[model samples]
Target: MFQKIQRFFDQMIVMRDARGGTEISLELATAALLCEVVRADHSIAESEIVAMEAMLKRRFSLDEQALDELMELAREESEAAVDHYQFVRLINEHCSFEQKFELVRAMWTLAYADGEIDPLEEARIRTLSTLLFLSHSDFIRAKFAAKPE
Candidate 1:
């Protein structure tokens, strides 16, 4: 019995290591990208955070705590990132064009959360949208689609 328990624990450890330190999901990575865009303007308001959390929860079907964990991990990764290319590549490899557009839409929602658009935020969003292969028109449509009615 003791040997069996030890083997089980050993297997668990191996599985954990194989999965890496943290299995940052594609959705979490996408959320991190959106967080980077919202924070680019250097005015991360509480409203924006709240709105982001809500959107992440709804979009990913995550519970509040899970969403919070995802957001926290995303923020840390965003801060550590040296450039946007890594994120763009990850998104491109993992997401479809429509999903990328939805990401841009989420960024737009966060940008407009405080009822005013910051110029820096807009610029970052534009750059990110372009990197994601979304045209100006598609980005605009995404923004409109995510707008609060």
Candidate 2:
């Protein structure tokens, strides 16, 4: 537990690259956001986890071992997070607009994975989309794109 906390906090490390700029783990940031949405619904749906695993693999090319590790780390990170700002900030710093749109789409897919959308889950995605600076049109587009048929 304590070790997990350590690893989670390590994702916040501020490091200078060769050009003296801050760099953070975009993977950790992304997974942490997924963890946030999973918990927001206040129910542990296996379907959400499954959807998230597929989305992460599709987006980042993660294998099973890597996915497991990331899920564990993200679980801890999201539990420790005071707000979504930490994860959103990382994404905004490292991700392009299209990347952020894909994340929003992925989140919508998770929200719909259990054959329904929880109010809290919807709110979480909206907040994340806003923080990502995604336009209302794009957010709506992604929601429609990911909504369960």
Q: Candidate 1, clashing residue pairs?
A: none
> 1-149, model 1: which lDDT tens digit per residue?
45743432343211111223543456656777888877888878999989988888888787665666668778987887667766677678778887888899889888889888888888988889998999999988987887787
- Can you tell me which runs of candidate 1 are displaced by over 4 Å? 1-24
What global local distance difference test value does model 2 have?
Answer: 0.81
The model with the greatest TM-score is 2
lDDT of each: 0.76, 0.81
Clashes of each: 0, 0
Worst 10 residues of 1 by lDDT: 11-20
Residue 51 CA displacement from its true place in model 1, Å: 0.6
- Model 2, residue 42: displacement in angstroms? 0.4
